[model samples]
Target: MDNMVSTCPICHQPTSPEWYFCPNCGKELKAKLIKIPLITQIGIYALSIFLPPLGLWPGIKYLGQKSQEAKMVGIVAITLTIVSSVVTIWLTFHYLQSYLAIYNGLLTNPSGLSSF
Candidate 1:
């Protein structure tokens, strides 16, 4: 009563500390704060490194959030991941079985990997 601060919009009674909506009238007294999990943040970051599609999960979670920065981060990260994956795949295909055979090292050829 004495230590209480503002009054509830509806009831007009004393409001508690940092209460969002007025308990009596159900009026919003404070702004809503959206929170994202740290794991999601880190996961999105990792997703950025691999494939953007892989990050779609976390990106959807943070989509249209109050924090535009986080959305941007997710978007950029995902894009990079996808691009990197594509580039890596392209290089692997360009090299084809030549590198595979060499890396595997088979006894038939100097770098054949049939035994492996």
Candidate 2:
């Protein structure tokens, strides 16, 4: 397996894989002209741009619990839905954790570990 350089069709110049378009002629040689269905690509691109999981956040979050990855996504969604502030985090916590972590008892004992 030898690393061979690819030559651009437009300029006939040696190109590296990193070279997206030919630097000489500025023509797209490595560009594969596959067309993604507009609606589907738009939806995914929308999610990636508006949502954080468009990156690799979900995969790492999924390591602990796949549902939590969903929660992380939901958290991002909830944050956007709410007025942005430290209060937005409270909304996210309320949305995700719900009534599970009762505040009444925990407020007095912050960690809530004092019960144990």
How many backbone clashes does every candidate have? 6, 0
lDDT of each: 0.66, 0.52
lDDT minimum window of 10 residues, candidate 1: 106-115
lDDT of 1 by residue, 20-101 (tens): 6787778876544554477766777777666546766666556555554456665666566677778878878879877877
Off by over 4 Å in 1: 1-32, 35-39, 97-116
Report the C-alpha lDDT of model 2 over 28-103, residue by residue, as the tens digit.
Answer: 8544433335564445434544553442343234333434234444454444333343454677888767655665
Candidate 2 global lDDT: 0.52
